[model samples]
Target: MKAIHIDRFVSNVTDLKPSTIPNPFSKSSQDIHIKITHAAVTHVDLLYAQGLHQNNRRHVQPPFILGTEYAGVVTHSPPSSSFPPGTRVFGGGLGAYAEQICVSEPTIRRVPSQWTNAEACAVGASGAVSYGALISVAQLKAGETVVVLGASGGLGVVAVQIAKAVGARVIAVVGGKEKAEVVRGVGADEVVDYRQEGWEARVKALGNGGEGVDVVYDGIGAVESGIRCLRYRGRLVVVGFAARGGKMENLKVNKILLKGVAVFGYRFGEDSRRDPQRTKDVWDGFMNLVEDGKIRPVIYKEDYWGLEAVSRALEDVRERKAWGRAVIRVCEVEEDTTEQKARL
Candidate 1:
């Protein structure tokens, strides 16, 4: 087994490296063993690696495996569980970058039969968050207009596609032409390059009846500007602050009230235990969109292969040179042991 861990916060991407890890398994009968094949890299992962995220109230130290989401094949599980042995699954698990890890059965979801390993690893985290913001928090209705800030990044790509899948017109906000192209390719109805002059004017001009969009799916810490992009009684779904160094800042309450809109802070996976039905709704919506071919995660594969390339993935995010959400190819998908035994 192999995995990546860091000793301390450092800006150098090359400092994180893969090291040998012993095989880990479930301590109880309810846990399932996963042979990880791919791990998704996010901007939050980069911030934590750099020791810049202030949310670590736990004083989470280093010399720890760095990922929380992964996709893999199940090698061991109790027979009575929903997912038996040999199930292919994707979801959250501690120390997820490792070659093998354990997770409780409820936390993982079955990977769609037609999806690839890389897609599964990337979708579970970002897809759910996007669905929760658009469908749950904002209650976005069909044929409405949505403005997705940071439309080329991980969450932004999903937000754009999800809004489109639900029959909403999507206006994606990116920094440049490169990001605009990517956002458009992912089903955004329109692309607004914030780098250009009067970009907000472009956003405000797209509304049908109101002054601006029906909802703003903001992941870029642009709460101030995103509120202005929303129409009357519209919603601003706050997902992240990657655009502002992962910090949560002040919001203009006056603007929010003046527009007669709502602002909801969405931490999608955080409320799963307390609101299981809501979590299911979001996950089901994402799966439905995926099954219907209306949405699919765009995987970034620049200089990425095996666990060693995790650093390169993070570096790409830091430099803003990556294609989309970075996926580390952890290992080859395991062959069917039953078929192998028959051949033997």
Candidate 2:
């Protein structure tokens, strides 16, 4: 089996290399062996490479497998699990950028027939976060106005479509004109170029006559200038800090007091770990929406880079060149003998 491993803390993109190792899951305690079909490269992967996410890497050692999102077929399953062997599923795991993976039953979810491998891979991390933010954190309601910052990136794109699917009027704040168009295409009612002058004011203008939005889903953090855009009694859900090196601006305590606004900081992984049932419910609801055609995963591109291309894929996501999700085709699974013979 082949996989990509980080030799050391990579300061730049060129530092990554490919290596050959034994198949990761062949010796695992779990019953299922997943032939990893697709693995999505994410900004989080880059952060890990640069040592920016050191706190997160504390438990995991070096020469570690880096990807978190994957979709593939199950070659085996424990009797206690609901999924049978040969089932197609998508889910998040600790290390996914390899030829094969062995995941515990609890972390996997069956992929619907209507979804392609690329779409399922794209939804792995971003979709779950968006669902948690909207359904659990904000408790969003129909017809409310929602603002999504960094609306062109992987997670933001999913958030925009999900908000619209829930009947919210969405205002998207993107980095440039090109990204604004991308956000608009994803069903945001209005798009603002946050790089332009007066972009914050423009967001207010689109709101209830310079008042503000009902909910602000800010993933970009500092770059979007989030604090100034909230309405009286508005809810701000902080999802990520994509804008690196930016300062966390102080919020005016009096403003919160006068406006009755609330700020909620969220980390989806923590929520999933603390309340597994809620996380499962969120995924189930999102799956239903995908089946109903109310929300579709926006896949930017697929990079079929055998196992060696993992470094380049991670760099592409880090530099912000990859728009939605950048997926790597890992390995192919052989058809189950019983199923194949039955078809004949």
Which one is best on lDDT? 1
| Candidate 1 C-alpha lDDT tens digits along 1-344 | 78876667777776888888767756887888888877888887887777776544454468667777888888888888888777778987457778888888888998876676678777767888889988988899998999999889988898888888888999999988888888889888888889888787789789765489988888889888887777778888888888886567787689988989889988865668679898888888788888898777788757477888888788888888875678887876537676422221
Runs off by more than 4 Å, candidate 1: 59-63, 301-303, 337-344
- On TM-score, the leading prediction is 1
Give TM-scores for every candidate, taking all chains together and pairing residue i with residue i. 0.92, 0.90
Name the Cα RMSD for model 2.
Answer: 3.2
Q: TM-score for model 2? A: 0.90
Query: Residue by residue across 79-98, what tens digits does model 2's lDDT show?
Result: 66677877777878667777
Error of 1 at 143 (Å): 1.5
Clashes of 2: 0
For residue 50, give model 2's deviation from the true position in Å.
2.2
| Error of model 2, residue 186, in angstroms | 1.8
The 10-residue segment with the lowest total lDDT in model 1 = 335-344
Task: Name the Cα RMSD for model 1.
Answer: 3.0
Model 2 spans with C-alpha error above 4 angstroms: 26-30, 54-57, 245-255, 302-304, 332-344
